[model samples]
Every structure is written in structure tokens, then in C-alpha cells.
Target: MQANSASGMAVHDDCKLKFLELKAKRNFRFIVFKIDEKIQQVAIEKLGDPNETYDDFTASLPADECRYAVYDFDFTTEENCQKSKIFFVAWSPDTARVRSKMLYASSKDRFKRELDGIQIELQATDPSEMSMDIIKARAI
Candidate 1:
């Protein structure tokens, strides 16, 4: 993962790839929220396997200024490549602030402490602080 200080944005390419791999494996139900031009929040529940391709996932969403998203994992079926018992919600940076905040707040309540603590810490800290914190947290 990379964090660009000049832009005040964090990049999690590896994490994103891992997430996509997991999603493809078990077709998880996910919610994506746009945080900004270079930031997104994802949440998942009962993730099974990943079956949807990147193109397929992106195409399903409404075209907007959304550059980042989050989602939950659900169940996957090998026969049809169609996710069963799936539920997803998405938002973009251009989405209304009130709407986005409401969604985030609600999701946070629903997903309280479900995400890894390191991810939560990274979200709460600045870029410079993230690396050290992540390293320290991981060591423990």
C-alpha cells in the first residue's frame, strides 16, 4: 500500500487485490462508499468466494465521480458464477455529503469492529502515522 502525502491519499493496491481475490473466491456481499478522489471504504458480511470480475463489478455501479468503494462478502455458486444471497450498496465522492455520511454512519453501526483493527487505525490516522502504526500493530 502507498500513501501519497502531497495528495493526502492512501493507496492499498495489495489490500485491494487481496480483497478482490477473496471476493472472486466466494462471491461476497459488499458495500462500497466513496470517501474522496483517492479514498474508498468497503464493508462485507458473510463473504464466501469471489466470482465477479473487476469489469463486471464496476459496470454494475452507476457511473459517477466514484473512485473508491467498499463492499461485503456473501455466498457464491460455482454453477452460474452468480452470487446468491447478495446485497450491495455503493456511494461516490460526488454523492451528497449528507447521504454519504448517513450511509457511513449506519454502516459503521452495523459493522462495528468487524473490520481489522489495523484498517480502522489507518483510517483514523494520517499517512505518515499509518506506516508506523501498522507495523507496530502487526508486530503485536
Candidate 2:
């Protein structure tokens, strides 16, 4: 694990590898990450399948926890062209503990900086904030 000295948080190598596989090879529909404060490291928590729906991606996120996720979103343009975009999400639900929220917040940049090729970024404290309607609106 390589740590970001500024944040005193380490990002596991698998996080980057998984991100690359998703970004370059489209191996996953989305990827979820969590921070272990005791270990001061960011690690992969789950990987969504390429065929999974957007609802599946959102369902994987806990209702009362903080997480960082990357999603590969596919959509059709008004002109009927198929397109895909990568999204980086910072999930800090309102029901989560303050300590957990703060830790995830402070360490976000360090972890996000490791995943490249992200075209959009969304930070949400509630499910509605990252709803599919909002996602599609932004994607379009």
C-alpha cells in the first residue's frame, strides 16, 4: 500500500489495478471502496458486474456509511449514439457517524487521485442526490 503522506492515508494497489481494468477493459460496471481508519488505508469493497443495472450499482452502497466509488455509465445520446462515461462518487450518507464521514472526507482526494479516466464526480449524502435521473441528466 502506498500512502499519501499529506493525508496519512494509504491506498491499496488493488484499487488502482481494479480501476484500470474497469476504465480500460470495461471489466466492471462499478467499483466500491472503503477506508479503514485503524489501518489508515483505502481498499476495494465490491465490484459490480458489466451487465448490472445502475440500480444495482446504487444498491451496493450502504445507507449509513461513507464510501468512494467509480462507475462506468452507459447511455444513448439524443442523436442515438451510444456513449459511456466514468463517474467517481464520494458517498457520505447523512446517517453515517461523524467520525467516519470526516475520515472519508479528508482522505478522499488522496484516494481519488489514484484512479484516472474519471469524467464526472458526484458527492452525495443521500440516495436522491445520486439518483439515476440525476446521473442520466448529468451524463446527457
Per-residue lDDT tens digits for candidate 1, residues 45-135, read: 2222245543344444444332223333233354545433222222343444555555454444333222232132223212232233343
lDDT of 2 at 87: 94
| Candidate 2 minimal-lDDT segment of 10 residues | 108-117
The residue-by-residue lDDT of candidate 2 on 49-105, one tens digit each, is 999998999999999999999999999999999999999999999999999998998
TM-score of 2: 0.97
Instruction: Name the candidate that leads on TM-score.
Output: 2
Off by over 4 Å in 1: 1-49, 63-90, 105-112, 116-140
Per model, state how many residue pairs clash. Answer: 25, 0
Candidate 2 at residue 4, lDDT?
Answer: 81
Cα deviation of 99 in candidate 2 (Å)?
0.9
